[model samples]
Target: MNVYFHTFGCKANQYDTEVVRQAFADRGAVVVDDPARADLAVVNSCTVTHTSEAKLRTFVRRLARGGQGLETVVMGCAAALDDGTIVALPSVRAVVGGADPGAVLRAAGLPAEASLPFPLSATRSGGQGVRSRGWLKIQDGCDEHCTFCATTIARGANRSRPVAEIVAEARLLAAHHAELVLTGVHIGTYGRDRTSHDTRRTTLGELLEALVRAVPAVRFRLSSIEATEVDDPIARLLIEAPRHLAAHLHAPLQSGSDRVLHRMGRHWYTAATYRKRIEWLAERLPILGLGADLITGFPAETEADHRATVELVRALPFTYLHVFPFSVRPDAPAARLRDQLPPAPIRDRAAELRELGEAKATAYRAARRGARADGVVSGRQGGKVEVLTEDYLSVYLPTAGWDLRPRFEVTVD
Candidate 1:
């Protein structure tokens, strides 16, 4: 079988797709790059917003009508929460509804022997080898019930992987890739579920410590974590072990307005508390790659609230921002909330926030023009190889001598 795999949504989803791809390859299936030549297409879904589902529907339909009669297997978040909508799509052969490679293989008509859970081995793309940083999923699902999010609805409550298993996987991934990104729905809340069952509770900090010792040659990066969850040990590792851990953090701040945050069921920390933690990290690192996700025009959000968010962004030393306009998902509680903002204001607010984010990113990049940092060779772009710096900036360098090492010392230009 010639299979073409495409993924949507977060890094967790990407990791899932890669695992599925490897499983297909193990069963002697040819994974192709183009949909036209493939007999089957595996599309991983995301249920974050209405736009995401719409795109999936459109893509699935197009694949069906693309003259090759390509059949797609829809999996992931949308497949889980979809109310007969995804399976009803034309040319959708099967829907697995989760990131289970065994189910996906069965749906693809593979042999029953392919039902075992594939281990976290080194991933190779088209038999080329591991590319750039490897994504190591430490856990799945979320414990937090944010009103605006449907991730928990799709993925269920937080379920962490065993600590020993994660260390074994990290050691395996480190053999090929120099950096490993710890990914999950909520990675910061890594081991809270195991506290009751075991006397010695392991947190994300302890896991990181284990990974650092187990794979000292490979640097690890956190995919996305909450601001308040950056514990003392994690912070210390970022400050002290620069070579082992990247000095970058992507903490999601859904809304800067405390009232909006409360309405969104994000009661873990107030805006003031979030700011305090981020400011401390910023002050400690000379060039920290600080990023946050902001939602614009939430239900009942006022002009004053938007201004407060803008002010908060201005106060922080952010290298980048992922500004998302609030989109109503029917599965989420915020959909039924009173006083939802209109499309016009939501778009306007998102644009304003994005502009500010770009300015900050440009400034951060400019500041690092002459600074030398550790970087991994990402890929080729426009005849030059793009190197991703430790602080999460891209520096394009000549292709010569690129195959010498897994990482390079890059001077940002």
Candidate 2:
């Protein structure tokens, strides 16, 4: 059987898709790129926002109506949140939750056993397949009770993979010559769900240390982390880690005003503290790439609050920003709050912030000129080949003798 997987939202979902792919392959199923060419289509859905949920619905409906003889499987957050809706869809044969990917594979008639552990000493040629980068989901779910988030209801409470199991997965990915990206729903909350007192529950910092030590040659990248999680120790690691480790950090700063943050039920660092952390990174790491997530037009968000957010982002050293016009979900607290701004103002604010983000990104790219950056040549466009840097910057390089797949260090000109 040929299987097509369509992954949506978050690095964690991408990682889960890969795991599902591996599971299918292990059960003698071939992975195909096009949905029309495959016997089954797995839609790994997302429900982070109302917009995301709508996308999931649209994709499922389109695939169902296409009549390619492909069986549709709806899994991940969207299915977890609205299993009834997904199951009632025209061609969806299964609805699997994000919690257990093995269940999805099982539903697809694949092997559902626990994965075997591979050792760290394995070589790149010994793994299952080849890829440039890999996302290892070391943690999943969240415990944060933020008012605007729907992830908690979809994914449940925080839980972490055992350190040994994560290390094994990293080793396998490294053996495949892939850069390992550590991902999760809430990575900072790792180890909070462990039951044994002496199990040596570790922080994200400690887990990172283990990965680096175990797979020294493989590049390691982190998914989005909270502002409060960026302590001095993690900051030091970000600055001093081997060059293989990408110098990119994505922290979510949902809002800038303390009042809005409090109303959202976020107890992490304040705006001042977030600024200090960014400053710490700027001083230590050269060519550091900073990304942030901002939600505008939340319930009760005044013009003053929006201005504070804009001002704070401008003052910070962020290379890019992901601006989301806040959407009210069914079960979240902010959904019922009063004084929601009109859609026009919400869109206007988002547009302004997006423009600011592009300017900041251009400045960041310009700053990288004359410096050497390590990246992989992804593909060719026109006559020039595109290079994707470790920190996720794309630069076009003149194609010559360089292999498009191999990682290389190119001097930015």
Candidate number of the best lDDT? 1
The C-alpha TM-scores of every prediction are: 0.97, 0.91
Off by over 4 Å in 2: 110-130, 195-198, 377-386, 398-400
lDDT against the true structure, per candidate, is 0.88, 0.78
User: Which pairs of residues have clashing backbones in candidate 1?
Assistant: none
Off by over 4 Å in 1: 113-115, 125-130, 196-198
Worst 10 residues of 1 by lDDT: 121-130
Per-residue CA lDDT of model 2 for 1-413, tens digit only, reads 98888888998888777766666666688888767788899889888788888888888788877647778988888888783877888788998877365688778877666643232222332133335666788877898889887789888889888888888778777756547778889998788787675266688888788888898887777788886787665776777874656888899998888888888888787788888878777888876778999888888888898899999999988899999998888767788888887898888889999999999999988888778888764556577776667666877876676565657888765
**Best TM-score goes to which candidate?**
1
Clashes of 1: 0
